[model samples]
Every structure is written in C-alpha cells, then in structure tokens.
Target chain A: MAENREFFNRRLHSLLGVFPIGLFLMQHLVVNHFATYSPEAFNNAAHFMENLPLRVFLEFVLIYIPLLFHAVYGVYIAFTAKNNLRRYGFFRNWMFMLQRATGIITLIFIVWHVWETRLAHAIYGTEVNFDMMATILESTFMFWFYVVGVVAAVFHFANGLWSFFVTWGITVTPRSQKVLTYATLGIFIIFTYMGIASLIAFAY
Target chain B: MAEDHKTIRMIVQRQDEPEAQPYEEEFEIPYRKNMNVISALMEIRRNPVNAKGEQTTPVYWDMGCLEEVCGACSMVINGKAMQSCTALIDQLEQPVRLEPMKTFPVMRDLAVDRSRMFDSLKKVKAWVPIDGTYDLGEGPRMPESKRQWAYELSKCMTCGVCLEACPNVNSNSDFIGPAALSQVRLFNSHPTGSYHKAERMDALLDDGGLQNCGNSQNCVQACPKGIPLTTSIAALNREATLHSFKSFFGSDYHH
Candidate 1:
C-alpha cells in the first residue's frame, strides 16, 4: 500500500504539480511584467503565442490538461481531509483552513483570468491588448482586483515554496525550514511589490 | 507579570473514542498562586467535578516529565498548541480552552496514538546503525556548530503539535510531517547515520514525504520546542537536489 501510494504521489507530482504549476508561475510573472514596459510589447507577445502552432499545442496538452487535473484533485483532497484543525488549537486550525481557502481562491481566480483573457478573446471578440488590460486596470475596481490577485499569488507561491521543500525532502531541519519559509515569504513580498508596482505604472 | 490571583474558567473538548463524537466540558478551577494550564488540569483531575456541581469521570490526559522536554503533555490551550506543563493559568484568559492535538489518532480524551509519527521515523530509518553491542565506543564527532544544531533537532519529542498545525498533513495525504522530517535530519547528520542517509533521503524524496508540506510557518510558531522546521527542510532540499544530481550522473559519492 505504501509503495503504491508513493508511486501514485510521484506520478501526480511530475504531471500535475512541479512542471505545470512552476512553469505557469514563471511564465505568468514574466509576461505580466513585460506588459509594463510597453503595451505593444505585451500585445505582440500575446499574439505571437496565439499564432504559434507548437506553443498552442503544448499549452493545451501540457498546461491546461494537467492544470485541470491538479485543481480537481486538490479540491477533492481538501474537502475529504479530516478536521485536524480543531484538534490542536486556533492558529493551527486557521493555518490549515487558510491553505485550503487560498487554494480554492487561486482556482477561482485562474478560471476567471483565463475566461477574461483567453476565452473572451476567442469566443466573444473581446480585445485583450496590453492597452485594454491597462485601461481596465486603471479603474479602482480592477486595480484592486489585480492587487488582490497579486497578493494571493505571492502568498500562494511563498507558502507553496515552503511546502515544496518539505514535499521534496530537501530541507527537513526545523531551523532550516523556518529560515527558508521566512526567506521565501520575504522574496514573495518583494516580487509581489514589483509586480504590483508594474501594474499601477502600466495602468496609470 | 503580577501575581494577580483571579478565578478563571477552562473549557476542555473531549471525546471518548476515535469514532465517537466530541463534547465540551467546562471546569472552574480555583486560581492558585503560580499555576499553568497543566496545573489547572491537575486540579480538575484531583476534584473530578464539573461546573454543574456533579461528579464526573476524571478528565484523562497523558504526561511524562512535568518539564516541557517530554512533549507528552502537549495540548491546545487557549487556542494554541504547546506543553501543558509550562502553560501558566494566571497568564491565560478568563475562559481558556483545551483540546488534544488532532493530527494523530485520539486514544481517549487527551491521549493520542502518535505511532504514526514513530512509524514514519522507522520507515525513514531515523537512526544510526552501529556495529555489535559491546565496545564500538566513540564512533565519531561532528563540528561544534553542527553538533549544537543537531542537539536542537534531537529535542523533538515525537509531539504531533507540528503535524496538527500543518495544512498538508491529513488523512488525504500520508505526509509524515515536520516532526518525522526533523528526525530524518537528526539521524542523517550523524556520521554513522550518514551511511543510511540515501535511504532516508529517498524516503523523504518520495510521495507524502516532502512534497506535501505547504509552508505556512505555522509549525514553527506552534512548536513548543521552537525547532527551526523550515530551515531543516531547506537544507534537506539542497541536499536532495545534490543527491538527485549525483544519482543522475552516476557519480561515486561519499557519505
């Protein structure tokens, strides 16, 4: 049973977790930042990908397929998980619940983001040029939406970084895990600020 | 921190069995001179009375050493997981709450089956294999700095507090959790234990071992021993990467 479980877990890690999530994070950060320098730059980048057969194929096969599987599996596990939160104490329970809540929020945001940016372009003839994004972002509502999105992304990444190390058997020492968790959070905050600043600058 | 002796109420969440439902029982223990939550629990156990002025079964719990070293007496007091041994009643709120750490299977009211953690330790071979029983004395010595931190890592009491605090450790995942991972570090750092380092590392590198942790840093805050859990996980990450690289290259690596 243990061996089978381990096998199943490894399969999930490779297909659903590391490659899809990590690649998406890196690409999302890079693309979002690029939009700040020049609206045309982002528009060109978006168009270039949309026009590429190989890129489109890879995105469909590698990104979307695994992403959907992982999200569904995550929700399933979360809902089925036993209520250990109330067993220990408040902070513990809250942290346990927070991870699940954030994961759900991220899933919701991802769907909406994809719909607004990608599906809308394909189905509704909605323009998603860098300028359009900037214009929408200039509104206080959308600005805050982007801000909240960035914060959630940062928290998710930082927390996931901490979890990833433990999951991979990289840093097992308590002291080391603590230090790295703090360091990861610090790095997350820095990137989040950068990403937010770029958004404000691009919009205004 | 004044000796302001004031009456405080305590609410304990209790369950009879693993499958049984949980219920809350309140007790009003007299404010003592210098009492912690453990002492308050002790007082209630001594009297075996509830707020309703009725006789009840003695509230059950587990404790080894009265000091914080044992980690056996760990409980959620006032919504925080820590050693009940060290919790001061005077420093707590008026109506404090207590509950068992939820990560492990509850044996009774406050006692839990922490065998899951111990089993993980066994699975990872969290120990050094030494030669024959007699006289193989003084195997090896580590650097002072390394020894100091290793000692800190060795302080883990198999307490499930960290596990209870973690979001990743649950029934859905077989996550061995922070306590076991820290133990892996403890044994892996040993010069003799390093021989089995590959096995331990491989175990952690596998599913429900390392990949399940969602680093919220709550474990550190929840840990009564204040073990640097995240730091150890980071170092293990670097080591695992190096190990993976070595494995990929099929290089001759020394323990």
Candidate 2:
C-alpha cells in the first residue's frame, strides 16, 4: 500500500524530470545562448521571456513546483543511495554515482542561481537582462563557480534522460539502450557547450 | 606443457563461526589440467593444511549438480561473483582469491545465507496460482515469440549472484534485488500467473520493491543464466506505472 505511493512518487519524480524540468533547462540555455549575438539581442530575448502572459502563474505551475518536488525527492534518493563502484566499476555504475553527485551539485547551484537572478528580480526589482549576468560572471571566482554549476546541471539532465527512457519503458532493449547512450552523450555535449559559451560571452 | 608448473596458489577467506571475523588462509595445491575451482577446493578439504606450515579446519562451501544449473556453488572468485564449479584453474589468475558473497550473511567460508533471495521470491509470490479443485477453462496461450524470451528468464537458478553484484542489496537496505524483480515479471507474464498478476504487482509496489533499482545494470551483466534482467525491470517499470495510474484516476481498483 505505502509502497505503491513510493512507486508513484518515484515515477512522478522521473516524469517531472524530463517533462517540465528538463524541458525548462533546455529552453533556459537556448535563451541564454542569445548572449552570443549582442547585448541588445540577448536583452531582447530575455525581455521576451519576461513579458509572456501570466508569466508568474505559469512559472509556479510549470517550473517552481515541479523543480521543488524533483529537488526534494532527489535529495532523499541521493541520501539513501549506496555506491559500489570500487567492486563493480562498470560504465553504468560510474554513471549511477555521477547522477547522485551532480544532483547535489545542481541543487546547490540552482538555489544560489535563483537567489541571484529571479528572486533578485522579485525582491530588489533588478532587471534580468545582459548587464545583470555580466556583473555576476565578471568575478573570476564566480565565473568558475558558474562553470562548475552549469556543467553539473547539464550532465545531470543528460544522464537523467537516459534513465528516464528506461524508467518510463521507452527504450528497453540493449540495442535501443546503447543507441540512447550515444544520443544522451550528444545532448550532454551540446547543452554543456551552450551553457559555457553563454557564460564566456557574459564574462569576456 | 611446462615442467615445474603443476601447482596453483589460492588465498581463501575463512570464517570459523558465523559471527567470527573472516581471515585468510593460503594453500598451494597440485594443479591438474581441466581443474575447476570446486575440485581445487575439494583437494584443500582433503588436506586442510595452510601455507604457514599449520594444520587447520577444512574450508566449507555449498555445491550440488556440479553444473551451473544448480547455482549452489556461487562465490566471489577473484572479486567477481560466479559459479565456482565452472571456474577453471587455467582461466583464473594465479593466487586466486575466494570470498563469500557479501550481500547475504556469511554462514561459513565461501558460503553465505541465500535465504534473503528466497524470502524475496516468496514475497513476490513467484509462482502461478492454480487450485486443483476445478478446471479453470482453457487459459490464454502465449505466442511462441514471447515464450522464446520468457524462457531466458526461467533460466534463473536463484543462486544469489544478481544480489551479490548489486550495491543496492546490502545489510542496510531491503531492496528485494533484481533476482525477485525479474521473477515477478516471469510469473506475471505466464497465462496462469496472470490470474494473480495484481497480487504480485502489489507485492512489488510495497517497500523494498521495484523503486529500489538505481539502474546500475550490474544484475544483467552478472547473471550466470544470461537473463535479460534490465529488460524485465524496464517492462515492470511500465507495468507499475500503468498500475499506479489505474489505481489513482480510473475505476476503484482493489485487490
């Protein structure tokens, strides 16, 4: 009885990850990638997102609630997870450890990130545009912090996608699983590049 | 064939009592061609002498059928859990290390209590339910194609290898492990077993059930029977997911 709840909660965690959480991450990176153009271009893109109708309500329903659940349940999972990579050092074994590790890293990063940007917008009325990001990344230490945070976030998402397919029964066979591994690796590389490139544009 | 190469050095992990601390004992055996790990152990048993010029109690292990089918003689040989019956001396590295599977309680040296796996099997009801009282009308037949793959799952000998390989099934956690999870899929897929599929699924939905899998994927690779364990897990994941939805939003479904 209670186990079913656990099962549902776990599946919900997995589903929420790829659906709203993972989707929002990709969208966020693409929007930030606009920085590669010019300040006006990036500002225009950021402003366009900010001006969306019912933005606050949509953010709560689609982003904050789901992200909160994923993060909370993810922490429970990470705390309870036991790693055995020393004896069973298989590829997937390493991946399992990394997933948990990056989840923690991503959670810390997201909390600080929300405080710096979105929450700043709400509390201090700071504009979430190019200048704000430029100042955030201007510091050498903060720039490296963003680099670690961004890479961890992307890796967590990409690896989480592979298990998402399995958890949802999308790719069940070895051949299908192998194919998705390569596909997810591509996703990791592409997302990581976009995230780091945008940061570089802001810093330099 | 080379001269002066007729010996095999082995380091065996020994525990005198169930609660005793495990210790190592080295033995030098007269190696022979086609010698499997079991035969080597038997030699050591016949003469329980240690390399330090001391007499000791014979090492104890579990074995039957002397074939992989029985799955009784499983141990961690050279850091990998496998059937000692087929572990040929020639294939193993010198000074071969042997240890009991740590996932379960070490009953004695190189033999741990596998009752945990059996308990899991019992919990999941890994059997088709049928009463002899009445003829349940012709059960639905399965396709030959599906049977072909299902046969792979039936090969599980319950040797406890999968659990040994899984990090999730340790002293602290009651994960039920991949062995029983795969068994649930096997029985549930059967025409007769499908009669009680809901019951088995409920058992799986309980704590220490399917949600414990972290997808380490070592079970499928470690299974001596070559069972597609991860595939079974994935299929069950889908089944559990649908079951959750039905239980939540659909008709009041109950056991």
Candidate 3:
C-alpha cells in the first residue's frame, strides 16, 4: 500500500493539471477579447462572474490549492529528473527549448496579469476597468508587451496541452494523437486570433 | 533455403559495476527462427563465450514481461533505444551492437537506474486518493471516452527507452523524460484522478517536467508498446492552460 503512494500521487498530480489550466486559457482569451466589444460588455461579463457564488468558493477549495501543490512539487521533480536527450540530438533539443520558452513567458505574463487586474485594484486602487485597459493598450510598450505575452501564453498552452494528452494516455493511437494535434492547432489559431483582436481593439 | 547462410555478430558495451571501467565485448549468435535480441542475450548468458573464443562473465541486464508491457529490458540496440525482448534479430543487420541506455546512470552492462521516472510520477501525484485501502466500495465511474485513453496510458512500463532515445535527456539536464510524462497522462485521465488534475498540470509547467521535452518525439518512435508519448504531452499542455485560469479566478471550473 505504501509502495503505491508515489504512483497514486503522480496520478493525482496529472489529474490536477487538466481542468484549471485548460479552463484558464479559454477564459483568459475570451475575457480579454471583450475589448473588441465595449466596457459595458466586459463589466456585464465580470458581473456574471461575480454572481457565481458557489463557483467562486470552489475556486479556493479546488483551483488555488491544487495549483500551489502542483507548482511546488513540479519544481522538485524538475530539479531531480534524469535527462537523457543527447543520443539523437535535434528533437529533444527543440522540446526543451519550447518548454523553457513557454514556461518563462507564462510566468512573467501571469504575474503581470495578476498585478494589472487583481493586485493593482487591491493595493493601489488602480481600477482594471475597460477604459484603463484601453489606455494601457494605447501605449506602444504595453501593446507589444501584451502581444509577446499572449503569444508565449498561447504557444505554451497548446504545446503543453498536447504533451499532457500524451502523458494522460488520451492519445493512444497514432491516429488519435494526430487528431488531437490538429485540434490543438485549431484551438491555438483561434486563441491567437482572439488575443490579437483584443489587443488591436484596445490600441484603436 | 539459401537464406540459411546469413549470420550476425554483435558488439556489446559492458560494465560489471557502477564504478568499473567500461569495455566492449563481441558475441556471435546463430540466427534462428523467430529470434529476438533478448533471446540472443539469453544465449550469451548461458554460454558465457565471446566471438574470440574467450570465456567471459555472463552479460547482465534488466527485464520483466517479455511482451513490452513492463518497460524493463530496454537498452540501446544497434544505436536505437528500445525493448530488447521485442527487437527482432531478423530485422537487424549483421554485427549488431548493444549497450545500456545513455540517458540514465548505468548500473551494469545493460541496466540503468530509473528512479527519476518514478520520482516524476510521485511529483505528479499520479493516482486517486482513496481514504484507505480497506474496501472503499465502488469508486466514481469515468466516461467511456476517458477510460479508453486511460487504458492506453496504463500500458507504460517505465522502461526508460524513451529517455535513452530522447536527445534532451542528458548529463547536464534534469528532464524527467517521456515515460513518466506518459504516466502523468494515464492518471490524469481517470475520473477520480481528475481530482488532482491541476497539480499535475502545474508539475508540467515547472522546470524539467514537460518543459524539458523538446518534442523530438523520439520517445514515441522508440516505444515498443507504440504508446503515443508525444500526444500525451500535448494534451497536458492544453490542460495546464485551463488549470492556470481556474487557479487565477479561484474557481471550480472543470466539470
């Protein structure tokens, strides 16, 4: 029984990654896209979000707790993992690069996003209203920053999702994996479009 | 049949201990009907004789289920890392070579340490949390679609062949490799296992977890069981994104 603890833990960890991460990407892109419409639309969406009492409560119990546990544990596994990619060369090298690139981008973007939306409001009374976002986008520096951040976020999200599918065994057949990759490509393109639209709306 | 004239010689890299110096040894095994590399090694183990007519120590390696289910018996065969038990001798050229997988620390002739793979599995918490082992009556049922993929991921044997075949797994890096990544997919697919899905996604987002897989996809090509190792990695990437969002809003998003 004790012997299976590690096995069970690994299984749970993989499970924990699927929902919040997957859901986050979709919501982030959509919410940001509200810039394409109007501040009223954005606030309406936010209001709808605010009214979800049980869901909000569940967020603390489910999402936050799991994220902290997984991130900390991820550091541990990564530091201690055995690397063996030197044999064939090219493919492994690229995989490592993408992984690193996406992680860094996602990390930086996440911090900035939190600061811009959550923390800024909490500490400095800086409202993350639609007008503020529009103003921020008007700045050349912020526009490019969001662009890079979104690109990094998109690539990281898609690639990581593809990898996660394989890790979870959803891609057992070569055909199935191929199908999933196509879906990944489709989702990535759509999300990219959404992100760009939001950015342009803010700028204009 | 004129085909009976073909013969093969093998050059094997061998070591007797972790601290011992490595050396090359040669063996010539007669081609037989339905022969595979593991069978050839078994012959060498039985006879303990080399191509030079010198008596030698029996070659040592690791193996479990011969059907590629256990993931043991994985080694570099003819420069490609795979399961020796399934490597058909007939498919190989003459004088085939064998060695322990380079991505891992070699323990002996063809055996390497795979603790890192298991450790990654641990970091991911790849299991359902049953309060206790004592008759936890029926668990939650999973959707048929998820069960299908979960069944597939369960086939992993943690042979470390994927690690050996990957170019990123090396001395300087801490990549957890593909086998463990695939295992993460296996557990995350479960209905009960979904409870910890976010944690697993976070693990991949972290260093040396999924970030280290360069998508060379050699592990998929190298796996004897034909598990879609790369595909699982991709799916996890998407899942991680969703996980990130749910984390941000502090909400219960996934149904």
Candidate 4:
C-alpha cells in the first residue's frame, strides 16, 4: 500500500497538468487572443476573472494550489533526475531534458510575472490596467523576457501533455502515442500563436 | 626485453568503509596476453601496490562466473557500466577507470548493495508459482513464436547496470528502474506465471513501478545482455492500462 503512493502521486501530477493547469493555460491563451480582437475585450475578461465572486477562494483552490504543487514537485524531479545527453543523443532523450529545462524557466518567469502584476496590485496597491501591461510589453528587455517565457510555458504544456498520456496509461501503444504527438504538436503551434499574438497586441 | 616491459595503467575508485569517502588509487601492472579487467584486478589483489609503488590495502570487488554469466562483477569501466569479467584489457583505453555502480549504495571497493533491485524483483513477483514439489504430468506448452521472445526476456541476470545507467534511479527517487520492470513482462508472459498475472500487474501499479521512468532510453543501451527493456516496459504499460480498466468496472467486465 505504501508503495502505491508513488504511482498515485505521479498520476496526480500528470492529471493536474492537463486538467486545471492545462485548461487554465488554454483559457489564458484564449483571453489573450481577446487582446488581438480588442483591448477592451481583454480588460473586460480580466476584470470578470478578477471580480468573480469568491475570487480569492477560486484562485487559491484552482490556480495557486495546483501551480504550487506542480512547480515544487517539478523542481524536486528536476534536481533528482540526471541527464546523459552526451551518450544518448536520441530525440526523446533531448525532449526529456528540454521538458525539465523549460519547466524551470517557466517557473521563474511565472513567479516574476505574477509578482509584477497580481502581487504588485495586492502588496503595493498598484492598479492593473491596459496601460500598465502595454508599458511593460513595450520595454525591450521585458518584451524579450515575455516572449521567451511564453514559448517555454507553451512548449512545457504541449510536451507535458504527450508524456502525461503515457504516464497515466492513457496512450500505451506507440501508434497511439505517435498520434498524440501530432495532436500535441498542433496544440503547441496553436497556443504559441495565441500567446505571441497577445503579446503583439500589447505592443501595439 | 621491451616487449616484457609492457604494462597496463588503471585508476580505481576505492573506499575503505561503507561510510567512508571514496578515493582514487592508480596502479600499473605488467601487461599479459589477453588479460581482462578482472585479471588485472586479480593482479592488483596479489600485489597491493599503487602505481607509485606504495603499499596499499588490496582492492575489493565482487565476481562470479568470470565469463559474465552471473553478472556479479558489473562496474563502471571507463564511464560505461558493464561486467568487468568480460571487459578485455586490449580493447580499453589507457588508465582504465573502474568505479562501483552508483545507482546502488557502495558496500566497499567495487562492491555495492544490489538489494534494492532484488527487493524490487520480489515486489514485482518475478517468479513462477509452484504449488507443490510433486511433478505434474506435462505442463502447458508455449507457442514457439511466443517462447522465442520470452527467451529473450529470460536472459536478464539482474546485473544492476541498467539501474546504474538510468537517470531516474537516483538517491532521491524510488524508481524501481528498468530491469525489474522488464521482468514483469517476463513472468507475466509465462504459461503458469500468467495465473498470478493480475497480482503482478497490481505490484507494478505503485510509485516506483512504471511512473518513475522519464523515458530517457539509457537503460536499453546500458543493458549488457541487449534485452529490449523499453519494449517490455511499453508492453507492460498496455497490460497495466487494461488491468486498470478491468479493476475500475469490476472483473465481470472483460478478461
């Protein structure tokens, strides 16, 4: 029974990635796409998300809790796992290494982004608005940082989705996994487009 | 006279005690025709002298079946995990470095505690069940095609080198590594062993079982017997998935 905990924890990690976290990531891309449509729509969606009843409770339950668990456990996995890329230069091995690397970079970027926006509002009484986002996006350094961050986050989710299927026994056969790989690649392309488009909207 | 002066240089990682820090000791032994790493180590055991000619404690390593059958002599030779008994001196580069498999805890010099692997084997029940000592007339026969692949799986010697090469089988993670996982395929495929197939599947349904593998593909290359460890893992994943579905909807659903 004690031995079973490791299996469950890993499954849970995979589950959380696709469900609340992956779903949230997709919805975030969609909301940012609203910026491509119009800033008013983007701000309105953001306002609705921020002002939802039990907003703090929802954030705690949905966003913060899952993100905390995934990020912390991911960091633990990254530190524990070894990489032998020199000997095994296979594509999957490199993907495995990239997954961990992107996970770490995404974690740092997420923390900084959250602090700059949400935490700043909470701790310093700063208002979050289109001007603020536009100003940050306009900065050359911050612009490049977000670009890298968005790429890392999207790639991690897309690749993670592929791994999650195998880890949870969802797609066991190589053929099925190959199909899912295409699907994940599509997700990567679509999400990346949405993310970059939103960032471009902020610049303009 | 110059031919008689040939020597092989070796650098071995040694530890005096289990709790002691590991240190490197270099040795140069008179080159002999067709000498393997084990032969070189035996010479060092005989001489107990470093390359600098200083007296030292005899180097310790585990070995059985010098032909690499028992897998008792596996260690890292020049950054590759393999059976030392089969590692020929002629094929190796100079200053052949020998170190104990790091995946397992060091017991002493070139000896490690492989109990974790055996324990995982037990957990996965890598065996055929026997009800009694009495012989039953004519056990069920396996198809030749199936038997062929099963024979491939049976070649595993529990060498612990696969675990040594694996990145997930580190100190921090409880991953059972690849060898035992492959054994799961081995035992589950046996005619009589298939009777307890569900139980074996259940054993691997836990943390260290299948989930810990990050798909690094090192174990497949590191396996000295050339067993298809990853292929076994993939097959088991399919089996385990079916098992989970059966368990969820209750056994009456399907076989």
All candidates' chain B TM-scores are 0.91, 0.95, 0.89, 0.96
lDDT of 1 by residue, A1-204 (tens): 254354345437534565777557756666767677777777777777667779778888777988887788778656745554554445434645665677688788788778887888789988877766777777898787777776776666666665665655565666666687679769687778767866876787
lDDT of 2 by residue, B1-255 (tens): 783488889999999878999999999988777899999999999998888869999999999989899889999999999999989999999899999998789999988889988899999999986667888777788999989978999999999989988877776677899989999999988988888888998899888899889898999888988999999998998888787777767787643
Ten contiguous residues minimizing lDDT sum, candidate 1 chain B: B210-219
- Candidate 2 on A1-204: residue-level lDDT in tens? 454677778888998999999999999999999999988999999989989999999899899999999999999888776677877899998999999999999999999999999999999999888999999999999999999999999999999999999997888888998999999999999999999999999999
How does the DockQ of candidate 1 come out? 0.30
Candidate 3 residues lying further than 4 Å off, grouped into runs, are A1-204, B1-7, B133-135, B249-255
In model 2, which residue pairs have backbone atoms overlapping below 3 Å?
none
Give per-residue CA lDDT, model 1, range B63-180, as digits (tens). Answer: 9999888888888777777788888876777798988877678777887888888888888788888777797788787999999979998888887888877767777678888888
The top-ranked prediction according to lDDT is 2
Give me the runs in candidate 4 sitting further than 4 Å from their true place: A1-3, A34-65, A82-91, A118-130, A170-190, B1-4, B133-136, B251-255
What's the C-alpha lDDT at position A101 in model 3? 54
What lDDT tens digits, residue by residue, belong to model 3 across residues B1-255?
A: 655675568899999899889899998776678889889898899889999999999999998989878878888887778888889988987788998886778899999888888887887777678786687777688788877867778888778877777766777676778877777778777767767776776676666666565455777777777787877776765565455546656565643
- DockQ-wise, the better of 2 and 3 is 2
| DockQ of the candidate models in sequence | 0.30, 0.57, 0.11, 0.43
Residue runs of model 2 more than 4 Å from their true location after superposition: A1-3, A120-127, B1-5, B135-143, B253-255
Expressed as tens digits, the lDDT of each residue in A100-189 for candidate 4 is 999999999999999999899999988787668898998888998999999999999999998877775667665777798899999999
Error of model 1, residue A101, in angstroms: 4.1
Instruction: Order the candidates by TM-score, highest first.
Output: 2, 4, 1, 3
